[model samples]
Target: MRAVMNAILNVVLPVFGIMLAGYLVGRARILGEDSGRALNGFVYYVALPALFFGSMADVPLARIFNWPLILSFGGGLLVTFLFSIAVALVFFRGRFGEVSMHGLTAIFSNTGYMGVPLLQIAFGQQGVLAAVITTVITAVVVIGIGVILLETDRHQGSAPRVIARNVSLGLAKNPLILSALAGILYSWSGLPLPQPVATFMELTGNAAAPAALFAIGLFMVGKSLTEGMREVVWISSLKLLVAPLVTAWLAYSVLGMQGVDAKAAIIQAALPTGALMFVLAQQYGVYVQRATSVILVSTVLSVLTLSALFVLLGVQ
Candidate 1:
């Protein structure tokens, strides 16, 4: 019992401590909104990409694929993606674009920011491999589908070719996706990350977590979490509860994943919704308020749920 509490303290405190610092910083208004954007740009375009690239560089090609783990994580993510769409359609009476937006918010975990740091804190650098893979998958699968739905609507009545072109363009422009691809290609080619290049990436990648957590804090400040209670509760519940359970079951039963690998899949599945989903919502101008509300609620609840989960899995 003492050990469990210790594990929680060791794992949870530092992670949330950084977040608290970010929140306090935001509350103090030491920096303006533009500073927050610059921090986010560093995280998304620079730090996260370097992290993913280094994670994959020179690792065995087979290890990177890690089929059982991938199956468990990807299957769980896909199920939640579909589940959110159904809920939006039936309960919310949402339109096509709104449904797509809902699906994005529900399925896309905060893998790049929270997942990387949380897993590293819990399981050390070895754990980051799964986090990186999960982030890459989210980029390709979630964002790809989002672009399809969003572009399809904008180009309503146009040929499929136009939509495809737009999707390709968007994917090309995303540093996260391109970095993952580069990492995989480098691994496949059996090339080593050169010493100087590796050092540069490591230095930059180390900044990803703190910057991301702090920026999340900055973004949370001045936002009204008051209005979207009903939708927020519903979405957060599914993201925190249902998604992790499904991933664990699939990992054990369907994928035959056990031990540390199974735990990794489940943890990654249970992360709070990514703020990138909020970016998508803002882009489409649909369900922005509810999306914002869902992220905060999910993040707060995940502390309890994730702590219990680690104990159950004996990961702590």
Candidate 2:
């Protein structure tokens, strides 16, 4: 009992404590209203790209070759995404693009912001491969599909050729995806990044978590909670409950994963929705309010659930 409480306090405190500081800063009006935009821009264009590149660049090619782990992680996310899409399409009866956004909120774990740190605390360096594998999967596959779907919908009625060209450009230009690709290529090539260059990336990447949380807090100020409570509840439930369960099953039964690898995958799956989803919501202008609610609610609930999971992992 004490261990679980410590786990919850230790893990959840630092992450959300920064967020709480950000929230207070927002409430205090220190940076003014548009500061959120500046912060978001930093994270989106600068911090996140640096973070992805540095992390992927350092990963061993051998780690990249772990087919079972990669497949299992990607499979878990894919199943959750498909399930979320199905639920949205059936019940919400929305346009396919909008439905895809809904599904994205349910499936996109806050792995970069929350999961990596949690894994580090629990599993040490063993967690690195699992975290990087899932982050790569999340960066490449999850966000990639969401961008394609939403971009196609956004450019509706354009010439087919124009839409195709635009979507190609959009994916190529997305900083998150492009940076991850560059890092993977660099790692594969086994090239050495210069010391100064590597240090710059390390510093920039380090700023991502705190800056993101602060920006989220600033962004949340004055946002109404009343508009999308029902949608928020459903998506949060899907993210917090269903996604992890599905991930655990896939890792165990399908991938034959056991011990720390299995736990790493499951805990990551259980993280709250990524703040990057909010950036996407802003970019695409789909489900913005509901996405906000999902992030707020899911982050809060993850404390209890994650604490329990930590205790469970410790016992095992």
For every candidate in turn, the CA RMSD to the true structure comes to 3.5, 2.2
Residue 225 accuracy (lDDT) in model 2: 69
Candidate 1: clashing pairs of residues: none
Best by lDDT: 2
Candidate with best TM-score: 2
Model 1 segments more than 4 A misplaced? 1-28, 93-98, 110-160, 274-291, 314-316
Whole-model lDDT values for every prediction: 0.74, 0.79
| lDDT of candidate 1 at residue 158, scale 0 to 100 | 55
TM-score result, candidate 1: 0.80
Per-residue CA lDDT of candidate 2, range 1-316, in tens?
5644565566566766776788789999988778877887888899888988888888877787667666666777788888878877777767767788888898888877667766676678888667877877786678778889888888878999999998898888989888888988999998888788799899998898788777777767777866868778888888887888887788888888887788887887888887778777766777766777788788889887777767666732
